[model samples]
Target: MTDENARHAEKMKKIKAARDRMMETKTEEKGLIMVHTGPGKGKSSSGFGMIMRCIAHGMPSAVVQFIKGNWDTGEKTFLRERFADEVRFFVSGEGFTWEVQDREKDIAAAKRGWEIAKEQILDPEIAFVLLDEINIALRYDYLDIDEVVEFLLYQKPRMTHVCLTGRNAKPELIEAADLVTEYTLVKHPFRDGVKAQKGVEF
Candidate 1:
């Protein structure tokens, strides 16, 4: 073979070897915990997208809403109809903290919501659990950070994936997570008084 052809053949062999190694190391099924946090929109939306993907793959999922109580986004409504059995939503029912005007009440509602979220965590059959707005809950001391970390470490169910979404997620939660996504807010139309439109930011 020509020198140039020999080099190309050597590169092809290396590529095949790498591909074989990857295939050998690949797992058929695995579970992990992921956190999406930062001062940007679409955290919950991203979680919901993964939930849909899991549903497409016939995996069960559950969602627990911490801060959002009465604000039913379009995604929630759609999932209720399409993936009702695979999804669950636990709302605080207290609305926004400022709107509620009661710090203690917000914490109480958050604790109540965490009860349901914890239940979902223990469900081994549910392949995924999205803790929506949990960062804010932990930031405001609405949920116990140490307890949450312990649950993630020791109480995680077998073959269960978890996704926690909100701004400023707790450091402990990030440390315990297998994957973390921090969304940076550059600019949003909401700054220009644009309302959250359905099928977009809902």
Candidate 2:
């Protein structure tokens, strides 16, 4: 073989060995509290991706949408229609806070959503729970952050993976998360006068 090809092979061998060693160190496994937040999009989308993974494994999962109303979306429709037996979906919000324009109503909806989330989290049969857009409710003080965090960190089932998605996640929630991903908004189509497209923004 050429000298360049020989050098490339040598470098890959070292990388594989290092990766194997690092993977070996990761032996302990437990349910993870994951937070997906920031100004960018895809927070809820990413949470759904995890739910799809759970479905692929035949693991039962549940979703409690805290801020989005009963709007038609591809993920919602597909999951509910195709995987009804493995996924339990709930939409607890009437609409966005700006649209609802009633603090009392928003709070009531958030509380109702939280109750549903708690049920899913505590269910041993459920392996994954997605509390979609729950950070918005927490940000607006529609729900008690302390109570939510306490229950998630202490009272959740040992093998249940819970994901919280939205912007402006509480500091306490971030501190309690086992995995956190912040979606940075470098650019967006909305700013360019492009409306949200089906299968992309919904």
Candidate 3:
């Protein structure tokens, strides 16, 4: 063959091989639920780490701070300034359950926050959702486990990711989750009358 014809033939062979490889490789999308529980300080911290990882990969994330509505964590402030519209954070006006003791009011606040959570959980743009302290709310009967599970199963966008953190995680949640981490409390500063610090515990 002539030089021009030989060059064209080589280009055609390369194109054919590329087409075959593209046909052979395929990608499937799926979602995941990660639970961080047990009596420790890093449950929410772990969830936030996952959020940062997702964002680093150009994935959007949302955070729903349930029981810790009033207490301002550094993560919340950082997210507010950096991500702003990308992260959706909803905090109930009422603080902790022990402080409130108003069953009706606490439930009402949780339900409202859960409704907002439901929206964030289903949104396709929100690749990862940090449900900070959600397991504790479920354990305390502030939210319905079945309802949350059903929503996780049904409402999640294709390839969406979820992270839940709190203590005393129920068996059902553990079973439903793809990854579960239990942070055992071997040692903590709070036991020695150390109050929650600004950047650490808040």
Candidate 4:
């Protein structure tokens, strides 16, 4: 028993030393362009989680919802009401492609949304901006990817973090991003004839 305990203690000590050494090389403290893309859910949820963190730290946050109709989502309503002064929220999409059924209008909405999004992102006071479903817009070619990436490169503030969340993220946006996370769908109740619930799916 004594020998086993000593081995465990030595292993933990080595692990801690290695971890501390690796941490020493990480000296960056600036905003990041994070992308969350996949077929599964939780892309926007994770982006909203970042907004929650920003709000907790007393930093302002903005949300530009693209390719998603303005639903009465709990998070949206809560943030709009609770942090009215600290957050700016906008929904620029009428609905999904199947529902919208018009290419010209879709393009127009995307252009309008991107315009609003740029306004929020260029504001240095807002520490976090969630470009919800922006990837979908790019996938449909509703907005110019090169223009978006250029704006992100030259206009973003040093202390402002931007989160782009959706499926089918463009290659250019992913390459320009500082962090990328892909969520794989393993199982979902909707496949089993279950509808999207109020709190969970919405």
Give the top-scoring candidate (TM-score): 2
Select the stronger candidate by lDDT from 2 and 3: 2
For each candidate, the alpha-carbon lDDT, in order, equals: 0.84, 0.92, 0.82, 0.89
TM-score of candidate 2 on Cα atoms, chains taken together: 0.97
Model 3 stretches with alpha carbons more than 4 Å out? 1-29
Q: In terms of lDDT, which candidate is strongest?
A: 2
Q: lDDT (0-100) at residue 171 of candidate 4?
A: 95
Provide TM-scores for the models.
0.84, 0.97, 0.81, 0.94
lDDT (Cα, 0-100) at 137 in candidate 4 = 88
User: Which pairs clash inside model 1?
Assistant: none
TM-score head-to-head 3 vs 4, winner:
4
Worst 10 residues of 2 by lDDT: 67-76
- Which portions of model 4 show Cα errors greater than 4 Å? 1-5
Residue-wise lDDT of candidate 4 within 148-174, one digit each (tens)?
999998888877889999999999999
Residue range 1-202, candidate 1, lDDT tens digits: 9999999999999999999999998766757889999997789889989988988898888888887777877777888877688777566646767878888888888888788888888877788898888888899887899998898888887578889898988889899988999999999998799887877877
* Better by TM-score, candidate 4 or 1: 4
Model 1 spans with C-alpha error above 4 angstroms:
1-24
Better of 2 and 4 by lDDT: 2
lDDT of 1: 0.84
Model 3 lDDT at residue 158: 60
Clashes of each: 0, 0, 0, 0
Off by over 4 Å in 2: none
